[model samples]
Target: MKKNLKRIAIVAMVALVIAACKKNQESAETAPQETVKNADKVLQYIKDLGFPASSIVDNGNEFVVEEDILFPKDMQIPAGGAGTKIEQYYTGSIVSATKKLNIRIFVDPSMTSMSSEINSAIAQWNGVPNSTLRFSIVTTAPYDILIKNEALAAPPGFVTCGQAQFPSGGSAGALVRINKTAIASNSFAQRARTICHEFGHCISFRHTNWAAQGESTATNVPGVTGTDALSLMNGGQCNSGATVLSQKDKDATAALY
Candidate 1:
């Protein structure tokens, strides 16, 4: 009788935990969307910026423009198509750098366990020749970037390897999501590369292969025009992408930062 009672207690506890998780998820889904003045006009504003209609996904609170940009539903549309609030002033253009050279990257509790991969990604950007841009891990308030792990399921449907929030207000975007579980089994180099790719986005890099990816247009770095087969900033390559920045990649970084 005691054994049976203990078994019942364990099952009850498990059910309670599952119920809590379901409630949390439900709250997230029902959270209020961003407050936009006009949904249709805001959408038109996005289209005016060169994003095709198909690339835009109405995600309730915001529009997922392209595979990376998150356009909040409540943002004030600029009088001109180009808005000061945008991370990148122009598509295919390098993102503007922060006022300070040492950019602070904070790993959330969920991502701290992957320190080796995080540091590896940081080293690549910090070692860029002739560039003042640098990335540092912080453990306190006022961080420039937050890298966090996200649980992503795959099987019957496809999900992106990771997502990055672009810099805004002249600083690095505050968030970078890493699908740790999905790529946790990748080689050390590949794991680092996945992170490296997302960091590149945080700084305003358009995929080098955007043209081939059906983006209507992508601007070339002033002097470094043309496709780079080994560019580390190529999107959709994920674990198979270039593990290090190519010569053109370095040139582009030097040109911009």
Candidate 2:
């Protein structure tokens, strides 16, 4: 009788521990779905966009791609694509409406502490010569883009840094997420460059060195094709790359805009 009771107690304890582990997992996996309507739709959307399903990360508010681009669950899925070097540009599907000159960025309270770095980023884009494109910070709503701080999952010693949404239709994508704490130890210039790099994504620029980076492919800007050693649009250089737009970077924006 004593042996039987001990075995039953051991089994009960095991079951209780297993049940607790499962409960914790469910809570961790449950992110607010917003208007995703059908869970399968997001998976299909990723496939239709030519992204591998394995590249998808189930971030709470949006889907992160290439560790830097963001796709909100509620965003309208783009209808077509831009073709090319398989590395530089996103063609028409990702650019802001050509006529929309100024992009308003509203920083989240969580990100406001880095105002100086954010301002430097805005100045770099606004200073792009001959391009009507401009970025301004606003404290109130009626804003076109929101910059927020978000913690991303990554392996130890590796950080996702920042993520931006590609413009769909003619408007600039609505958000940029900075891993504020991850890059806090970087110099001020590096911090600003991190912001600068993400904003590049908002306007449809791809890693200028994508081919070298092993990105599947990218289309170069017309009349401005090929690699730019000084390109600010290059990815994977966070906290240690070009701090300003290179001359070609300016020219590309001039040509595109």
CA lDDT of every candidate: 0.72, 0.78
Q: Which ten residues in a row have the lowest lDDT in candidate 2?
A: 81-90
Candidate 1 per-residue lDDT over residues 1-257, each given as its tens digit:
99999999999999998898787775754333334445666688767656789898887766766565555565545445444322211233233455438788889999988899999999998888978888899899788888899864333555567777555445665578888877878899888988988888777676788777776455666677788879888877767889998888887777668
RMSD in angstroms between candidate 1 and the native structure over all alpha carbons: 12.5
Q: Which candidate number has the best lDDT?
A: 2
What does candidate 2's lDDT look like per residue over 1-257, in tens digits?
Answer: 99999999999999998898787775754444336564455556655555667777877757877788887776765555322222235534545544348788999999999999999999998898888888888889888789999996776787889989877667787889899988999999999999988888888777888778776456667778888889998878888789999998888887766
Model 2, runs deviating above 4 Å: 1-49, 79-88, 94-99
Off by over 4 Å in 1: 1-34, 38-45, 73-100, 152-157
**Clashes per model (N, Cα, C within 3 A):** 2, 5
Model 2 residue 133 CA deviation in Å: 0.5
User: What C-alpha RMSD separates each model from the true structure?
Assistant: 12.5, 7.7
The weakest ten consecutive residues by lDDT in model 1 span 85-94
Candidate 2 is scored at a TM of: 0.78
TM-score, candidate 1, is 0.74
